[model samples]
Target: MSAGTIALTNNSATVSGTGTVFTTDLKANDFIVVIVGGVTYTLGVKATASATSLTLITPYGGPTATGNAWTAVPNATLVGITAQVAADVAKAIRGLNLDKANWQQVFSGTGTITVTLPDGSTYSGPAWNSLTTLLNNKAAKGANSDITSISGLTTALTIEQGGTGAKTAAAARAALGAFSTAGGAVSGSITAGAAAGIAVAAGENNRVEINNVTSGVGAGNPVGWTVYRWYTELAQTGIRRAGDTTIQSYFVALSGGGGWEFLRGGNATASGTWTSGSDIRHKFDIEKVKNALASVLTFNGSIYGKKDGGREVGLIAQDVERACKEAITYNGDRKFSDGTVIPNFKYLNTAGAAAAYHTEAIKTLFELVELALDKPDDARALIASIKEQSEVIKNTPIENEDPRKEAPPIFDVPSSEDYEEPTT
Candidate 1:
């Protein structure tokens, strides 16, 4: 049944039609019979179809009026009835509902079906394929296609799990620095080669040989190899606080019942400990005494003295003040005839001033020593100055004396009678 209308213009190739006979109802290449202007024509074949229009291969007779009745016609047949029956049979087969078993029977033969993946890899096999096998194949293809063997691995290797790309070993090493060689130096269970000479054990018995050769030929000189052994031990029983711990405790422990002597020095803590054999103790003693003498020579009245309640001795503030006062020279005030008292020369009574004075005194004393060694004339002049000061001190009067001509009487008598009245 058709409820279609065609409105054609003067053109004979295309006719505009509005109808229910479009793609849903009629397919391309389908023939339709139309009657226009009361003339019967079987002229148009559907080239394209839409809901409201049909594009025909050849337009119907031009200027056809609207409301033309049209009907879908069976394709023209070669043998008339046979062709029509065959077409009907084909349409019936297309509409039939075939179940899975019937479809399997129809597609029973094995055939190759190729499928392409997103990564441009293809899989070819029967339609039914193993999911696991397909996935493994995809992974293998990805690994092979993306990257082959990576090169340029030498000094080190970096296995970066998540980053832009693989980094070179040298680049990683440059960033992180070299690994420590201490791990390689460790003695393990693996044996050394025979070319390594003798293997040294981890004890005092381990020794290295030294070769000594004489250059010139003279009398045969004695060549001897002496091995000196020094042993020390430090032991403590209980835990101690960091502030309470001292070097003396460690020294006592390390001495191990030997005759130990302490050498005082500029360093408050013990510099090092010595066992019985070496001259470290003597060397330390010399250094300590020399340093002590130096300190005394430049004393400036300050000494490393003990605090009132504390055990350790150091330069105290009061002592430093006293040293400053002693080292600086103060000039007395001058009085002029005009009755103006000029102030004494001002000097800073400070540790820095004291140190400067001490340094100057040391320098002067050293100059005197140099004079005594090399310049006798300068030494004599210095000695003369000392003698002149000594003479001035020697001649100075100890007590004041009266300048009167006659000796003054000790007691005053009230004339001659004052004494005579006292006799009664």
Candidate 2:
């Protein structure tokens, strides 16, 4: 390492250094590492220009920069190996990488590939290029046609014989696209250990699959699936499943709410309507809903504001949890960025559980309705008495009433928008 600060003009072959000793540390073919903007660039030193500067055989093509830190490193020394042997070792390592990643080159023109066996024998075929292609052409793994003679192997096999039925490799690849009846990808498939994924053109369908034998199922996650739908103008939505869908473990993001939270679902659809499985075959011990009347009374249907600056007419989860614990769902505690922690809740409004905690309340209300229905004669006598009492009050004039405002009692539901305050 020599210089403190350096300057290199774009397209110039000179490297000027400040407070540097280039002639003492670098020589003709040695390389100098200059770090500019956090990126290191290695330039070959053509010759030692002077103590304060060194010449580059190739000019600096990067942006012109000054005050860069640099270091000098001579050509790497090879120990116990020639340059040819090092090149061969690199080639062999690259071949292994290509094999593990299922990488291949597609060529339309004619070419030859020589295969060197471990026995120090090399063979090259005029028609076949790779060993895989050559062996696939000659061998019959399934019930297919066979080539009995060497002259018969000149032409490619037919489709019935598991071959592409085309002579050239590119043509064979194109022909293989027509056959899609398989468990694996036939045309454009990238195997496991692929670093960079294969590219897909427009109008092509991109599939993200997890196979059983490949990198699919793993420990802790026996069956896991997630479906994503991207949106350009709005936030994306998705459906995810942790276990099988026969139970209530499926989840789906219905819409963007406070935080676009996912709602748990089951075999029932998460759209609008929901269904409860009431089949006797699937049920263990079933009974009628009791204490529904008590729950209805306990339900404090008051107007409340939501966290999203909107008002809603519903029961608070914490309040209802006290009254009806079944209606309230606990999904663990939620910690906010401001260090505020609160227990999260999920309200299953339509679930039978939403009406839990007291079935006797509902049963009491049901008995009242049944009583009103059963005793019709007694109800008629009570109604006749009420009519007579109402007539007596209407015949008499009230002290503080307006004389013109005389009418029978009228019962109707009033809309809040239409209701107005009464004048004194």
Q: Model 1 lDDT vs. the true structure? A: 0.44
TM-score of each: 0.20, 0.26
Candidate 2 matches the true fold with a TM-score of 0.26
Q: List candidate 2 segments past 4 Å from native.
A: 1-206, 209-276, 337-339, 344-350, 353-366, 369-424
Using TM-score as the measure, which candidate wins? 2
lDDT of 2: 0.54
Candidate 2 lDDT tens digits, 1-424:
5557789898999989888888888888788877776677888889887888878989997789988877777766322344879888998887676544332322321256444444446664343244445565454544455444343367777888777799876677668664332333543333533222222222234333332221233322323233232332222223333444422233344225212324332123344444467678986666554334433544566897643234656565544444344554556654433334444435544345544534555555455566569986765664455455434433443122112222433446663346454553
Q: Give all candidates' CA lDDT scores.
A: 0.44, 0.54
Q: Pick the candidate with the highest lDDT.
A: 2
Candidate 2 Cα deviation (angstroms), residue 92: 54
Predicted candidate 1 versus true structure: per-residue lDDT over 297-399, tens digit per residue = 3333433432122243333333332333433444664333334444452233444444454565566567778998999899879766645543443344422
Q: What is the lDDT of residue 6 in candidate 1?
A: 61
